[model samples]
Target: MISAVAYGWKVTSNAHKNHETEGFKQRAEDVDQKAVNIHVANIICSSIQPLQNRAVLNCIEEKVGPDEKFPWAKFRIEKGFGALEKLLKDHAGRYATGDEVSMADAFLAPQIDAGIKRFNVDMVKFPNFNLENFLCI
Candidate 1:
């Protein structure tokens, strides 16, 4: 059983590596666009993650209550998404950066996912933002 589990883990790891390698190759093909996407992703991370992450939310809920944390997280995510939307409007293609996938898309996709799934953020409010689009790439 142990050996079978180990083999399964190795296979999964290899598949993940292959997928990542393909993504990297796509990003490399458009260096300038990828850089822009990465910059936008950095902004998203800096502006939102600090306030919306699980640790901070847990701390807020512990200190105050669950109701309080939701409002706070919603406000921060909207603000961050506003900026992200503007950036996306200016530079976004099929993905956050451009037609090609990049580190920026990689970073922002998960953040949006967490925001919507965990915090119940209303993503539809951001006209220019689409988590599905980013994730598909």
Candidate 2:
């Protein structure tokens, strides 16, 4: 559990890529909001979830936290995910690009679920990010 959340934290880290793609095509403004970090993180982390299983949710608050982003290297997870929740929606939504799973889905699975329970995040603020995270496998 601690390991799973930590993995998600790593994916959500700042260094992860949320870069604008497709020639920077966006709706409101530049797609600086775009992110691929959660996807990769979820994928790897989600795979580990079964091992952690019940232990994962059992160890939030301390193991996982709020007000920060994920880190590939390692750091304070609670603080990192704390910052990330700010940019996401509370509920997971359909895949960003149709039904097919992308790298982003990987990170979102355990992450959003873990985030909601661990940090008490309000996903409305981070709409795009929220929907993706809210959805289940």
Candidate 3:
């Protein structure tokens, strides 16, 4: 079972690599943009999303109280969103990095969606995230 899972992960990893290779092939060659993209991805994947996942939420609820989860998630989301907003302030155009969708947009899109849909994050607080473009997409 473990071997099968590992094999499946390897296959999926290869597919994802191909997808990213295709994505990067068409992407613009801007080092600053790449840096920004990675930074945003790190913030969302590492800092924000982990805290709000079911396991963590459940742990918080189990350890503290059920009522504590929402506030904990809200605070983390807000802090991360605020950081993202400030980070994207100078670089963002119609999308996170530019008019055309780039690496940052790829990462930002789903996180934004989750923030709005799952966590009920207030969009007004993160104005510079260019929600209009992402929402339409």
Q: For this target, which candidate reaches the highest lDDT against the unseen true structure?
A: 3
Error of 3 at 113 (Å): 1.3
C-alpha positional error of residue 26 in candidate 2 after TM-score superposition, expressed in Å? 24
Give a tens-digit lDDT track for model 3, residues 19-114: 444333223457787678778777877667676578888987898798878777878888998999999999888887777766666666767787
* Regions of candidate 1 where Cα sits further than 4 Å from its true position: 1-20, 26-35, 62-64
**How far off is residue 104 in model 2, in Å?**
1.7
TM-score of each: 0.70, 0.35, 0.78
Candidates sorted on lDDT, descending: 3, 1, 2
Candidate 3, pairs of clashing residues: none
lDDT of 2 by residue, 22-124 (tens): 3222211223324433433444453433323445434442365532222211233333344444433332235532233343454555655664554454545
Cα lDDT tens digits for candidate 1, 1-137:
44322343344345445745544432444557656655665676578766755788899899879889888777877788888887778777676666655556656766677778877888888766656685564
Residue 121 in candidate 2 has what lDDT?
A: 49
- 1 or 2: which has the higher TM-score? 1
| Cα RMSD for predicted model 3 | 5.2
Q: Candidate 3, which ten residues in sequence have the lowest lDDT sum?
A: 3-12
